[model samples]
Target: MGKVTTGASMSIDGYIAGPEESGFDLLFQWYGNGDVELPTGHPDMTFKTTKASAEYWRSLIENTGALVVGRHLYDFTKAWGGRHPMDVTTVVLTHNPPADRPLADENFVFVTDGIEAAVAKAKEIAGDKNVGLNGGQIARQALDAGLVDEIGVDLVPVLLGAGTPFFPSLGVKPVQLEGPISLIEGKAVTHLTYRVKK
Candidate 1:
């Protein structure tokens, strides 16, 4: 079975997202229409020499086969009211379904009730590849249940103290670092990776 991975960025204050996350929205603000998109070769974008960051991530996402994300993140993605990421099937964990929802695009699927069910649905869709843990709560649930295979984080600079964290307090389990590298984009941004030790 392919490995399930969780990825996110955090701050020096141990916050995955900054206070209010108002600034967090600006995390990727550097890359937009007029700005110079950081070179794909830049270390921050791609973690390894053999793989371009975008390609690498696209591969992982393609391999994902399925995805499990919390409702909040799911809603946030749908806010734009257009195409969502992960062309593969997605199972959202939530208690109540929203009144008006995005139409299913063959790949989009919704699951309510609990975390285990969400993972099961994701795995069902995953087939041979592994499932990807989408957000903080979902990531934590997968980790707590020992379902996640790996965690690839892209450490960014802007710190958000009040917003949701990448990994909420998870009973102090030890996470050993695997392959890590620092990639620099133009001047202020950096991308880092860490493979969770099981």
Candidate 2:
């Protein structure tokens, strides 16, 4: 019994990343860069300050046990050179398996086919900690299959006019909010936890 968390920095318009994103440069631009803080005036909500954003990100990352991501993300991690905090047990979801992956360590394992297989493998490996659904597509798969129990979404303060949509196409389902926690430092970072009504 573990929670499935989906964490992403979305625009005010609800886009997760910019268009044609083979890799997560958009993710790096928003989460990686700490220089320019996301502006606070969002039509949907405001991120009170930058410190709040950092605190929120840290909190989410700290809770994640294992990661389930697409092959694209795995390749992106490889291109960015070796070793990342996400270098723990990762199950890459893809149709075609890679001939050779840079991460050959015992921690990294590739899962071809679908999210259920990936999730089952991750849970088997991750004993006690929670599982993190790495991307929008993967999240959709988990949500559709009723694998995810909870989600942690970080509402950043910028709107990328066009980018990856946070919530992709999926069948209707009920999700009830547990409670909202706010980390107020520079800005206000809110973690809205949701329980998927199964």
Query: Please, what is the TM-score per model?
Result: 0.72, 0.74
**Per-residue error (Å), model 2, residue 92:** 0.5
Tens digit of lDDT per residue, candidate 1, span 5-81? 77665554555566655555445432332333334322334222222444445555566677777778777756324
lDDT for position 14 in model 2 = 69
**Cα deviation of 23, candidate 1, in Å:** 2.3
lDDT of 2 by residue, 1-198 (tens): 566777665656767677776324433443444543333112332222345455655555566667788877768657224333543567778887777664335556778758898898878766677788865788878888888877666655655777677667876555455644333333322345556656
C-alpha local distance difference test of each model: 0.61, 0.62
Candidate 2 lDDT: 0.62
RMSD of each: 5.9, 7.1
Worst ten in a row by lDDT for model 1: 41-50
